[model samples]
Target: MAERKAALNRAPARPELKERLERAKTIVLTEEQMQEQRASFAYGNAPRNSRITKASATSATKRIRLSDPQPVT
Candidate 1:
């Protein structure tokens, strides 16, 4: 379409976008920094009971049944 052709021709003026990409590429993490981040967020340190299985959800219902009181004989 005519609009698509116009947009493609206008794409070369975005120098700020190219600069942002260069800045992002400068933020690479070293091996030691990556290891420290992994150690800090290890699975063993996650909160307990964070996952709920189907069995756990169904088993948590009250064992007793609710009913009205019987009248005196």
Candidate 2:
């Protein structure tokens, strides 16, 4: 439609994003830092004492079961 074409021709939502990305600095993490980052994401923001290990994470999910489906009217 003509409206769709006009919308596509408009400027991007973030016109300065390209320049901002070009000016941004890149970080290089050491091996140990990378491992820590991975662990943080895997375990989320859980407390240290309650955080589950990777093995436990899989096992915990395995215990979950979906409820029986209800028939539609």
Candidate 3:
């Protein structure tokens, strides 16, 4: 009995698109204004960082002092 080789039906690879997708996973922004947003996604989709941590957000959250009535001297 003769053994026949299986044919590989491979498609042409698009390296450029692959590179673009890889780059999208780690979008870098140099502007300070967008630091927070960048940090939020720095880990690619995982919710694990200062920006994603619940304690960091709630503990560091600022409360409005205006909520209290001003003391009239």
Candidate 4:
């Protein structure tokens, strides 16, 4: 109980994820930017047989699609 109380008292000065997101939440899309991003995400550029359902995680190691930024397939 004493350790738990100390941990709570020394808890973060602010919510950590919220603090990180505050700096990183600047991805608002202009219409042109939205169109460009959508256009870039498909066709032969994407990985073949590349998808991640919940089951894929359990079977074995998975391939990382480093070729695609924010890899979509």
User: Which structure among the candidates has the greatest lDDT?
Assistant: 2
Give per-residue CA lDDT, model 1, range 1-73, as digits (tens): 8868776764557789989877866675554544455445543454677664444433332232324433223
For residues 16-71, could you state the per-residue lDDT of candidate 2 as single tens digits? 89766655434444545445555556577556888588656545544544354233
Quality of model 4 by C-alpha lDDT: 0.47
Between candidates 2 and 4, the one scoring higher on TM-score is 2
**Candidate 3 vs candidate 4: which has greater TM-score?**
4
* Most TM-score-accurate candidate: 2
TM-score of 3: 0.24
**Order of the predicted models by lDDT, top scorer first:** 2, 1, 3, 4
TM-score of each: 0.28, 0.31, 0.24, 0.28
Score residue 25 of candidate 2 by CA lDDT. 38
Off by over 4 Å in 4: 1-22, 44-73
Candidate 4 residue lDDT tens string, 32-63? 44444444544325466767433443222223
lDDT of each: 0.52, 0.57, 0.47, 0.47
